[model samples]
Target: MADYHSPTVIQPTIPSADMTALERLILGHIFDTEADGDGLYLFAEIGPSDSFELPVRDLRRAIAASADTESTVNAYISERIAALTDDDTHVEIDLSGMSWEFILQDIVRRSPTLDHVTAISAFTCTRMRPDGFGGMAVVITADAIRGKSTNDIVEDFLGDDAHDALYAGTHVLLRVREHAVKEQIAEAIGADPDLTSINPDAVTESDIRSACLDVVACSDLSEEQGAAEFRAAVAAIRAAERRDQAPG
Candidate 1:
């Protein structure tokens, strides 16, 4: 088995076909002036229906804008859609769990109308993608910090996204342990130097509890509260891990 808990990156993409017209317009507007915007175009009619490049800054803006109500966005798109004669126009924006924390902080700095709470809420929605098992998963890369001013990243996640959960439930992708936690866990569990170190399937509750202790030692949580919160986080990680390890 691979590192059952190592951070694995999965780049998510919204294909042109999957994107709403509003989403496409928002991206097109952002990428219009850039010369190296992959295939991104100012006009959807002229752009390819399959793929287009989304610059990091523009992608951040799009995620911020998406937090608005669906009707508000649709209204914006409706106003712009009249310019396109083709009904089949589409676009795709590729995204990953990486750099979202920095982008959220940037959004807070540049957009005065958006505060930390709103920006963080938007981040939750953008990081979420279908877990392919009728659920949604929030992709929190190893480097992505949960909260700007708070140490309890996992605990804050229990909060909803822009709207509601919008799926069966949401899980944080914590399979990849933080480097600090990784070293501690390896020593505590007596696992291999290589992070794939342990069999996820074989890990016991005692092992998970021990690992969770290392993760939240400095947290403000009392021992009992910390244990519960870490357990929730581990449960979510295990759920995603099971999906990944499921037999085809």
Candidate 2:
């Protein structure tokens, strides 16, 4: 056989899992994954593979050298998506309409080949939600790409969902603020003798806090504002009671 000439122009191949991990890291940093209004949230610089294997730094360096890292990451995503099997079991979620938790469970149940790790890593949310406004993506850090718990991933996604709802100025904020006010007022009532003694037997602290929260929850106010209003309401009620007990 003639002398074999090694090709110098060819690039060394890395495992597809490693490529997926790095691509996810790059994409996560490029988009608004957490709905924080920050497009570039750098959770991790060098995400590790599922096996905890380190990627070839040179491959990362080459991508960084590219003029548009976004395009480079997209190309990698496309390549991976193309390699996916044509199995009918594979499922991707449209977070715009469906619940992430439900879809995640469905993905696992439907796709026998997908364990928790692969299911999470291969899920559409791991990259982007096609139906989201501007295709809102999820933050797939090294831990997530390396196979974090499904519950953790789902929880994070739910948190992102909440953030998105808040960022969009939806009713979710109102409900969350109201719930917080109720808890804060409950805690205050528990700690303050004055609040507890206002109507100990006749009216439960729970009832009082609920009534106060009703007024506080009318407007979308900060927890501090709500708490302040709640305190003031309790004080007024206390003052009125004291006047009624005063000798005529």
The best candidate in terms of TM-score: 1
Sequence-dependent TM-score of model 1 = 0.19
**Tens-digit per-residue lDDT, 1-248, candidate 2:** 22221111101121222223334344333321332232222222222112222233433444455424334343443453444454423323112332222322332333334433222122222334442112122322212222354456678999999989878833332333445655676577678977665533344345556776777668556886678778978999999999999999
- Over 4 Å off in model 2, which ranges? 1-26, 29-34, 38-40, 45-70, 88-248
Off by over 4 Å in 1: 1-24, 30-33, 37-178, 184-248
How would you encode candidate 1's per-residue C-alpha lDDT over 105-169 as one tens digit per residue? 33333333433321122111222343211211233322223334222443456554532557545
TM-score of each: 0.19, 0.15
Give Cα distance to truth, residue 239, candidate 2, Å. 94
